[model samples]
Target: MTMDRKGLSPDQLKEMYRQLLYPRLIEEKMLILLRQGKISKWFSGIGQEAIAVGATLALDPDEWIMPLHRNLGVFTARNMPLSRLFMQWQGMQEGYSMGRERSFHFGSPEHHICGMISHLGPQLAVADGAALAYRLNETSRVVLAFSGEGGTSEGDFHEALNVAAVWDLPVIFLVENNGYALSTPVQEQFRCISIADKARGYGMEGITIDGNDLLTVYDTIKGVRDYCIRNQKPYLVECTTFRMRGHEEASGTKYVPDALFDLWAQKDPIAQYEQQLLKEQLLTEDEIASIRQTLKQQIEAELEAADSGSTLIIDTAAELDAVYAAPAITALPTVTDEMPATEKRFVEAIRDGLYQSLERDAQLVIMGQDIAEYGGAFKVTEGLVAVFGKERIRNTPICESAILGAALGLNLEGKKAIVEMQFADFVSVGFNQIVNNLAKIHYRWGQAANVVIRMPTGAGVGAGPFHSQSNEAWFVHTPGLKVVYPSTAVDAKGLLMAAIEDPNPVLFFEHKALYRSISEPVPDEPYVVEIGKARRVQEGTDIAIITYGMGVVWAEDYAAAHPEISVELLDLRSLQPLDHAAIRASVKRTGKVLVLHEDTLTGGIGAEIAAWISEHCFSMLDAPVLRCASLDTPIPFNTELEKNFLAKQRLEQSVEELLGY
Candidate 1:
């Protein structure tokens, strides 16, 4: 049961050898499948199998493994069924990704393995978050994160390392230095001596070793894992290896030199390990041959079964349902009180929601810039640190990508994270993590990204272009993200509570202009306003104005002034799952439509709503679907210019034009 640094016993050595051989044979089969046009692509871990097998085998079963595209041996060592492995490569419905994704971009929650996407470094922070969760829960587990030597150049790599070191999280970062990033050599990637040496900058232990040596890798990782769990800190291990094949099967080894290829091929990890076993008399020639034959037969059988398995049929309805998580309306406990509703500012109501959620759930964590002590840029999170303490109310660095990726890791450990962006415009810094990782996570692997990204949005008060811009369109355009923009104090509290409880990733946009200007009687009890529903502020029959966020306030004022025209105003609280039924009913009665928003005219969310009305309700409409939005230009700093940029006169003019039509 136990093995020392001298190496494993005969049986254990045989098992380790089998782990390496299985993936190599599987890679060979995948190459054949690619050649025969049965599979689309192949990313082999052919020469670096020792790193995958050794690192995975060294970890506890409860610990997590976030593997890159080339870590096929990790799957084999983790006891992933060979049939599912073949199914994944063949892109079948029975695979881990349910045929939604191709390649190794799929993970199993049961196995504690995170399937990685093409983005190289974001998952590092995710692993750090998971390790933080393990530490928080007092679970003696350490997460092993794998990345290429080239990934060290990414900002996320540094961000993850810095946070892991600062927090003393139990995460082991493994960099498989295969000497090439695609076709670029390691010399061209970084000027440093080794990737592991960079860990010194983050105040963590760093080690470099020959990746082809399975015993060294296993011993080093086992020691690192024990140290991390004992000290509750991170460590970096750089495995120096070579890629015998190309990045993928289609990408030939043309970029590599003949001499270098021959040199690495001679030092193949599998051949070297077999020779070591034979020299030590751990296994005879016949035993090694039998093991190889058994693996070959097993892989071939699994490949045949996977090839003949039923393919996935594209179901639009079921797929859409999976994209969005159902609102947790009934799951939340009721708080009944006879007290009157308390009047509060919009920002205060938002803070109240955070306070209520924190009081209700012990696993809730709030993280943002200046939120813990300075309150926030807009002072929305003021006094929260005193109530929840700094441990739960975290003030993170100004690294948006790492913040969001870490929130994802926290979510995986059943902790609800509320991430605040000082301004909505700044979300562009974290777009890849939000759009690629957060939004697509549910649809790609059926994993709910239960994090709320609070974005303070809209232009007003001469804050200039960058500080004040409506960036909801960027998130609304991305599928699998729930977008909410509440306009009132009551709705702010209710919708935010709903977003925090929902299993999907929600982009909660708070209008900065309404933060203090708006005050209303908000309920004292905890409640949830169902997402994907619109509130009809007024009912009329001549023209229907559909708007959201600050546009709802502008439309309400316009409808009040133009009562003679019988204007109906609908406030769309949620944007992604737009209240299409309300939109249709209002448009049906009025027979005229106007879609309004604060974002610029070009490619704004209003354009999508107008186009949808034209396509779906064209027959019932008496006039064209008109749109009212800011001009296609940056919001100016001057009060008059900003007023003109987002003037209510523009919306009224569009409504008049619709009425005339």
Candidate 2:
């Protein structure tokens, strides 16, 4: 047989045909297992195998491929063992995800392939971030990120594409436009003529192609990959195809039009490729039959092996350990009385911490809005850009989700990214990525999200609801994330340094009100204030006031004015890994507890601390565990109203009541 015009030899073409057949056969067996009650569910890519195989085959082995749920052929093309695939489907402990996650929600770091999360668009930015890392590391590798046409509507899609184009990252976004996004048809999903056309808006080339044609897909992807590698730029390719089956096994094809299904069935990619190979005299009918029989037997054997493997029961201890792996505390350069300390503002201290971390680690990258030229929204990263250069300190568009998602990708590529959300309130825009993707990544796939999100939080200076919000509780509630809110300049620098070094995701909330308002003597040398440990601000015996961030100042001020109440002030810097020992010790000594925070009264970190005190140190408490926080309402814009809303008088009154009790 003659070699194909797309540069594939007869053997390579046959191998491509085999790759297409494997996923189809595997899905068919998965459906059978589903019917037999051996599997819980299945999402089959029956008609889109050619697109997956072609796109992956065109990339170099070192280049990364982030696949969606329907792109099983991509895994098969990458030479993933069929038995391991079955093990994943069978939920065995030996699977890639160790049976922790179901379906295609697992990735192989060894293969440089990221598994898909339920939310589709986040991976787009992650792929772009990985590409950025490759460029910085001066590697020839590129990245291919896949998503459905439906995911194009998500904010992450636009953010990722825009960032990739602006930075000229080597990322190829392959969109599988399979006509429908689950139940919604293409016509209803978007008004645009083609999903690929959107790439033009992002200053990147966009191409639409027939995804069902194996050779066409292979040729198009090869050309696109070459362009991305050569120019260090991004390209978007939309592979127009159809989903021949339901979204999942139990979903049924009832929502699909029978006529449309019949129309696409005639264009079955596998059958078409087989006929093409036969027409070219590359394979006989007997050879095709032999290939099918061999694949079927191999799949069945894998299934048998997986079914005989030991089932994985949930390990509670392991689950807890995986949620948050605490970083070890390393000894810092000792401070001597002869060494003078510098008086720096809270923001300056944070900048110093970042400067030190960047100086120490070449892999550290800072990303946020206005972070490069403007030096961040609050100027916390000011002047450092000139010191570190634009490559290390990047200015991202106002895209919180993509910024965080891309940071995760950078972390995956061995680069630590510190993402700054201009305001704490704006973080809600990227809440899904944080709660679902970042927080759950380690627990589900064992991927470390070593990224720090710097949130300027608080309710002062009359910045109103949007700008002034202490939203630390949201992250503290998340299992896999570490939360830190430092009140003083010294702790701010120390904790920020520690957060940068930690191997887990840390939300570093810098009080917006304290940026220029507070100043203290900070160590010039690098130091790491251990995460999850509380600092004893002042030691006293009458009352133990436990707080963090701006609340610590309030507690100190109240104690100074009264002079009668002997308060043991403790700053609980880290919220998630709460210093229970400190809390119990203080409560045991004083027999009085007051949990104060600037966040709203209900469902605040204060409430969690109060509850812990009630549960653990109930007998030691002299008065009912007291709590003081902002009113459970949006922070008012007016200064007077805000003061009334988050009144210090109310806290003083509560303290008086507690002392009386």
TM-scores, all models, native as reference: 0.96, 0.97
Highest TM-score model number: 2
lDDT of 1 by residue, 1-661 (tens): 2323355577888888898788898888778877888778888888999999999999987788999999989888889888887787667888888778887898888888887878889999899878878877899999999989889889899989998998889999999999889998999999888898899999999999989988889989999999999999999999999988889877888888899888988889999888887887778999989998999999888777776778579888987787766655556643234535799999999999999999999998888888988999999999989988887898887888888998999877888899999999898989999998988888888777899999999887799989889888888888889899999888898899989999889999999999999898888878878788898988988888888888888887877776687878899999978999999999898888888888898998888888988899889999888888898889999989999998464976787678777
RMSD for each model, in Å, please?
2.3, 1.7
Q: What's model 2's overall lDDT? A: 0.88
Taking the candidates one at a time, how many backbone clashes does each contain? Answer: 0, 0
Model 1 Cα shift for residue 125 (angstroms): 1.5
- lDDT per residue (tens digit) for residues 315-388 in model 2: 88977887765564555643333446899999899999999999999999999889888878788888988889
* Worst lDDT 10-window in candidate 2: 328-337
CA displacement after TM-score superposition, residue 612 of candidate 1 (Å): 1.7
Candidate 1 wrong stretches, greater than 4 Å = 1-7, 333-339
